[model samples]
Target: MLRMAAILILALGAPAAAEPLARELFGAMAKPSAQAPEAIGTYARGCAAGLEELPESGPTWQAMRLSRNRNWGHPEMIRFLKDLSLTARQLGWAGLYVGDIAQPRGGPMTGGHASHQIGLDADIWMLPPSRVNLSRAEREKISSISVRTEDQTSINGNWTRSHHALLKAAASDPRVDRIFVAAAVKVEMCRTAKRADKAWLQKIRPLYGHNTHFHVRLKCPQGSPSCQTQKPTVAQLSNGGDGCDETLQWWVTDYLEELRNPPKRKKPDGPPPKSAKTYVMSDLPRQCAAVLSSR
Candidate 1:
């Protein structure tokens, strides 16, 4: 009986170390490629492995907010940025100013973004980049301006064709799954883009609070069987749009009403603001935990 009790106690005490919350583990990740490059799970509910950091500067582009240490992404996303930077200059833009890509292991972000949990999403500032060499302090000090009016009714004086050209270059990329921008930016695109370039309009998705920068997400890389792709949104599922559609009209109506009367935002329904349950490790794919555990 004594031996059995001792065995039981040892068993209970064994593996007593608590598992770290997913957000906590991911947040603490300092580097990438702890393992092979593998994007696992859905965007909001996913994590990635084998992440690589983007170079701080290139011939035509420079990254910002380096202190965040979010200039990392999957190899495909890094390549996409490299190609897009070159293309932007050729498309007559001065250069590109990139923002966050992903954290090293790519899990639930403690700060901005409900997505970008995988290595496929990135944010590029709308601020035109004329100079490729910007000091860390300057990069942090400079702010991107919203193209929307103060009232948010429509594009403001800051809106220019240069913005359109930059967006077009990003949307035109075949590897790009979608680009999220403000409704006003989409409305402007619908009004101005020539018919020949309208196919790219399908990839430009209008979402809230992207007036100062555009969000770009890439499609799953070929041969990535474990990577989950998103289902088609109503916009993507419904075919055939030259950008002039009821969707755009609805956005305009919504914008007008909001300007006249902004609705109150509801508090989130869930565990308290910083509850550990905020990021359920099991909610992510099994592979993600493995990614975090690797070197």
Candidate 2:
């Protein structure tokens, strides 16, 4: 009897098997929570409730990679994408080829992003649609063209005035917070923009690996009190001026040089930082538990 008791104590004292990662839990959900819509934390660390799915195909847009089922987003994002697709028509393109927005419940995804966790971000393909009626097979096989050249120093022939007009219209929208594109594209826009009409250029930020598509992030919708708004960048904080200066030049110059010859550094002597893939449920906002468990 004493021996049996000792085994029971050991079993009880042993740590429980680890809970699955948050991305695994959220990614398994194929539907949004049954509660009212809310964005519950920062873009990189949060979950959303009551997300709506964009239609697989629309009159002016088509959601790509339907197999991923990542076309879900907050209603405001759906409206914004539809509106932007219509705007693309004015530039003589058929419409936009919409990319991933977020998973149905908007938590850390299984792969492919660090953000898109709160349902206000989306990817718009640089490849304008020749037609919005692409077969599912065609979308999977097709690819977007890079506006910048392979060297990353300048815009290639694929970049056009229509692309400029489309980007300007998007950045000028009151609902948008910022747009991310390749650095070279921003430099070209800065060069060609009229001095009197350059205010919207400030929203066009340069980031690495956006040569094939641009990312659009929207402001928090009016009703989401728990949503965390992203802070402005240093360029945006500087007197509301268009970001057309030396800082922009660094991407093609010093940034490229570092990329070509990366400097070695000592590894930090601790556990690695948590990212979307590494996050567990506790790493997300408390309310995410409700979002994840809700039917």
Instruction: Give the top-scoring candidate (lDDT).
Output: 2
- Which ranges of candidate 1 are over 4 A from the true structure? 1-20, 233-235, 255-277
Query: Candidate 2: lDDT over CA atoms?
Result: 0.88
Quote the positional error of residue 47 for candidate 1 in Å.
Answer: 0.6
Candidate 1 residue-wise lDDT, 268-293, digit = tens: 88955433236656556777756766
Residue pairs in collision within model 1: none
TM-score winner: 2
TM-score of every prediction relative to native: 0.86, 0.92
TM-score of 1: 0.86
Once fitted onto the true fold, the runs of candidate 2 whose alpha carbons sit more than 4 angstroms away are: 1-17, 233-238
